[model samples]
Target: MNPNLLTPPRRHGERPTTTGLEIPHDQLDMFSPPRVRAELVKQAQALPGVFTGPSQVSEPSSLALRLRQPLGPWEAFLHPSTDEFGHIHRAGFLHLTLPRPLLAPLVEAGWAEQHPISLRPEWPDTIVMLYAPRDDGELDVVLAALRASWQQASTEKGR
Candidate 1:
């Protein structure tokens, strides 16, 4: 990750608004689903800026990352929001979302952070959550890997 991409110091009340972004939640896959999910939870606990920790919601368990660099609570949450497509042929597939303000900083961090990932401008400022699985030549693995990576990446970045 590019260290310079970090958010610059902000003034007393300056907050960034959403410009545009491409977040891919349907293209992530992994080698092993359950194992990867476990690793994700472990990593989330180990990483910083992970509040409420990674756990199972009404659905599957997920890790969430929130940021508050420039305002009272400029936050973004990343967690498993949907299930695998049940059919696909790739790993590293996932569904993820973030606040519009976070787009610039995240993309500036690296190119892999940006790609075929889609967006929903219809929603409010908050990004809806999604999930992706790993591409172990199967759908389950892809979902597992995607979920784990999402949690791990958020934990890693927040640190």
Candidate 2:
């Protein structure tokens, strides 16, 4: 992926609070209102090659965004059972995988942080916990991030 295009503008405002862990990982502040969350999910599901379903690696209540046909290898997924590159948490934040090259920029820009689990030697370093979107403008940035993730997960060269 081209880092230039995938790199989003620095997110405005202080970063929302987050738990930064796997089991209870979540955004603790600045949650998206129900209407905004719903709209974000709707638009994400409408992206090309995406389909929503129960998340195999997250809380059952969360929405999994899976590629209809994942072309990349297992490294592209957070878990192979669902081929999920990302999922929207109940609290409205997201857990997703991005290309390794994009991780630092995304985090430095205040858009996301590295998933704690990814710190382990066995895990891919691409996993990140994306902060929740609190409004329409933020939702647009989140969707753009998700779209980059989808493209990475679906392409053979994603790794």
Candidate 3:
């Protein structure tokens, strides 16, 4: 991992903000600027066995990560995709995978939201539950969640 994770100048360290919630250990901006989003893509690329490319999802365009091998059944590793118009978000959200233990705490803590189930019902349970990062002050938490997914999909797999 990069020691100096090139984050936006929101703040550094685990400091408490107006909301009384300690922001992610890493600093982040209030929103996803192009540079900030590019940094996210860069981090995902640095992971082992991760290859960045167009999403496997049927869309006009989007970014996604593919593992060198399948994690059980899914090939996609992470989902911080961009839209066809080159917008980082069609809206202003991104999806990521997290283990149940991680997911529950993050949900209760208000760091993430469960992905829309109607989007893809065929996904396995391991992947069925996804989370969208909050742009408020949780990009780092979101990035950390994505990193965990990469670790599970790449290193933790039966490689």
Candidate 4:
């Protein structure tokens, strides 16, 4: 991990806008614009194995996206399953941007388990559900999507 790249910004009174996932000790310090942007790009581009290492199906989703590999599994579930070893979520990209500067803490909290961070970008904002997958394969399609989205985001941000 790149220390300079991943380190959170230091702001004395800065506080994380509380989300539903706030842990007792998990405090999101200040996040820089560049850092946040990079994370948005990196997290989307990161290989699944680097973060989670291996793949397993503990509780597969029942909603079109199931347990197995990438795209194929997505066509399997209709109802979210408890044993599905993937990330199942609704709309939530905005929440994801909040953690852009805190990669280490997010990983430690099991945010990137095995599900791709599902996204629904809206006008001026994107709603995404970061279904963290433990395996690299799970991120395949997501990464591709991210690449496409990133291109647009970068263009919009003037990268």
For all candidates, the clash counts are 34, 0, 0, 34
What is the TM-score of each predicted model, taking all chains together? 0.30, 0.88, 0.57, 0.24
Q: What are the per-residue Cα lDDT tens digits for candidate 1 across 18-123?
A: 2225332332222226645454445433434333323232223333332212121122232232211111112312233443445455344321133232333433
Rank order by TM-score, top first?
2, 3, 1, 4
Error of 2 at 57 (Å): 0.4
Q: What is the lDDT of every predicted structure here?
A: 0.31, 0.82, 0.43, 0.28
Candidate 3 C-alpha lDDT tens digits along 6-115: 22233333322222122211123334555556666676677776675665542324456666654522423333322111112322234445554565555455454444
In model 2, which runs have C-alpha deviations exceeding 4 angstroms?
A: 1-7, 80-82, 157-159
Candidate 1 structure, TM-score to reference: 0.30
Off by over 4 Å in 4: 1-123, 156-159
Off by over 4 Å in 1: 1-32, 49-97, 101-124, 135-159
Q: Pick the candidate with the highest TM-score.
A: 2
Kindly state the number of residue pairs that clash in model 1.
34
On lDDT, the candidate that comes out on top is: 2
Deviation in angstroms for 47 in model 1?
1.9
Q: RMSD per prediction, one decimal?
A: 12.8, 2.8, 9.4, 15.6
**Model 1 lDDT, full chain set:** 0.31
* Model 3 error, position 87 (Å): 14
Model 2 score (lDDT): 0.82
